[model samples]
Target: MTSPPRRLPGEGTAHTVEQSAGELARLAMARMDETLGWYRELSAAQRSQVGLVAQAGISQFVEWLRQRERHAPSAISIFANAPQELTRAVSLRHTLDLVRTVVDVVEARATSLAGPGDEQLVLESVLRFSREIAFAAAEVYAGAAEARGAWDARLEALVVDAVLRGEADDSMQSRAAALGWDDVAGVTFVVGRAPLAASSPDAPAATVDSLRRAARHLGVEALAIVQRDRLIAIVGGTRDPLPVVEHVADRFGPGPVVVGPTVPHLFAAGRSARAALSGLTAAVAWPGAPRVVESDELLPERALAGDLPARRRLLDRAHRPLTESAQSSQSPLLETATAYFEHGGSLEASARALFVHPNTVRYRLARITDVTGYDLTRPRDAWAVRVAVTLGRLGGTGATPGPAVGLSDAGQPAPVGRRGLEESSNL
Candidate 1:
């Protein structure tokens, strides 16, 4: 068994300090106000609370001195009598200032306050008690800090859940507001695999911290959540999200990271979230997809996977523009594109099929690219155009049929180039 702590030789001075405790408490308060600016800044209510805490410290010191077998009072328990709000108003540093003032006052008066020849004992005891008070102050503040961190984490999780669920109601807005998301603009959603922790169960928090640190380094605001194996982030205050997402890409686990289109604010972020989630879900279809795939870039795969929004997007972004161009400009942009793809992207083969020169076919392909944003020469753009053409044919009404130049099985290609020249001359 451990031996009992040896008693300091100041038990005789215990009664001396008890008699002067009231005087010492008054002096400590006066010195704290005079020497510490923060102490004087405390509100009237907070000042009263500080006075009570100082008096308690001195009384507790005397009580410890009077006990034959001394036990230091629990430092954590010192703030128990004061209101919890007092800890918020008076910071730990300022509490140390009060403790220093109390120690200084007692030490300065030790010679007169102690019994004859016991001044040294009184001064030593004051030093020892001040050390305990400092330790106690640290414990109190640490506990408060821990509680605050936990509360903030829970609030963050709630806000993330609300965003994911597309619940942008007033209650959801209020929660986001509580988390200081009000100032953030141009919100975007990013979806990727969550990083695996090296060891600890707190890996989720560690992963989140890594994301936050990366975002801060890049001067962006981010809120993250780990849902099972997936990590989702709502990034804000950036119109250009690709660079921001690229900078923090390594924070995710090894997988495709997809960024959604940016919205104006957090409430509209649900649109971004939906698009990101759709891309993430269909990312596997394109195994060689980019590290940071824009949500719209995955439209073909998402549409093939039966995503209605993706299907609608393909039609709006590709088919509608080409059809409008063909009607207004009298160019067979769509027919030439269909023939070019069907003939395995051979310009000469498409030209013969359309009864136009190879140069004419090349010029029409360029116009197709201009209208649909897909260059028929590239493989990925060709595939996207193929999907958009299929969607268009299936959805279009009164699609005119002209030449059997390998359009769709349902309808012939509208001959608007050299093929249109021959037919119009015969007419």
Candidate 2:
């Protein structure tokens, strides 16, 4: 300088304070750059799935260490969800690997710091690194938990939308595919709506989670979604569906629960969901019956088997009693006919269901054609009879006619025509 520098009041005391603050700031900046550099190096070497998350974990770890030293409880809460997030983005496997890497680095640094002169610096750096690791883990855990919550929400929305519209979204199909659900031949959704008691130890929502765990334990891959108002789940890719259905029913309590039929693919999950919806609807419409409403089970054989003419004929037979004869109550006749044909012409059971004697059932059978003009006991009339019964039930018609003769030795009577009449055992 051309001249001596002028000093202000308290210049001597303030100089020392300014110098110390500046030094600490520089050190903090340097440490941050170093931490970031380490993450970049690791990312480059491993080609990790989420480099950004990894870097964020590193930065967050440093911040966590600082906050913890300052005793910041609020800051810890802010990062409580971070661990799950990190796990979701980078995967649990990678997180563990990164943790291992941090451990190894710390160990190597400790070994190098054995000399007397470097002890304090080594100790400080080790503590900082350890704190960072802990925070990163916390964040990753938080992230994973968050992802699960989001998945639950999305799944519910997709299911409800598909059910209401009678179709599935492409995004849901893709998400299922991403989760390795390739063998998704069909889909079925189950919901538990009854409000669990507040005091109950095992609530409905808790039961849903338990069932999900049970499915996983049994190696049945599935998704359990908990919504604000309901519990929903989708089960698929198995050779058998009944066992799973029964399992869910058992969980929700043998009370009012609904199950849909097996549909084509992941896209058909909604169809099943809607079926569950229908099952609930039907259960409400007709109380104290089976809560299950399979599309094929409730609809006529032809409708399920896709035989339109047979359905028309069965419907014609079922309704003929109601319209053709003012004296005849077509409702009971249709119910009996449906049960008889559905049971493949088992009179005893059909009679029992209709609360009529077996012979009364037999007389009713002989009268199907009299009312509908379609022979109930004929081989050619079987499909038509079945279809009519299904349409009748759905359209408020009655059952198909009973078999003319008794069932064969195998229990199934021969088809409508050319029957060497199997022995007609008294019902």
Top-TM-score candidate index: 1
TM-score of 2: 0.50
- Candidate 2 lDDT trough over 10 residues, lowest sum: 418-427
Model 1 steric clash pairs: none
Model 2 agreement with the true structure over 1-427: per-residue lDDT tens digits: 2544222213332333233333433333344335544435433323333333334443443343333242212323333434333444455445555545544443444434234444454345445555555665566467557667556535544444444344446765565555555456766666555344412434533655676777766656666544333455677666466677666655554345555566666675654664454344334433434544343332233233323333443355456563444355444566666778767777888888778888988987777666666666775455555555445556554443332222222222222221211110000
- Candidate whose lDDT is highest: 1
After superposition, candidate 1 runs with Cα above 4 Å error:
1-16, 19-55, 68-71, 82-116, 195-202, 355-372, 397-427
- Model 1 over residues 198-288: C-alpha lDDT tens digits? 2246777777778888997888889886666667788998999899999999988888999999999998887787778778877888998
TM-score of each: 0.77, 0.50
Steric clashes per prediction: 0, 33
Q: What is the C-alpha lDDT of each candidate?
A: 0.78, 0.49
Task: Assess the local accuracy of residue 344 in candidate 1 as a C-alpha lDDT between 0 and 100.
Answer: 99
Model 1: worst 10 consecutive residues (lDDT sum): 406-415
Give residue 84's error in model 2 in angstroms. 9.8
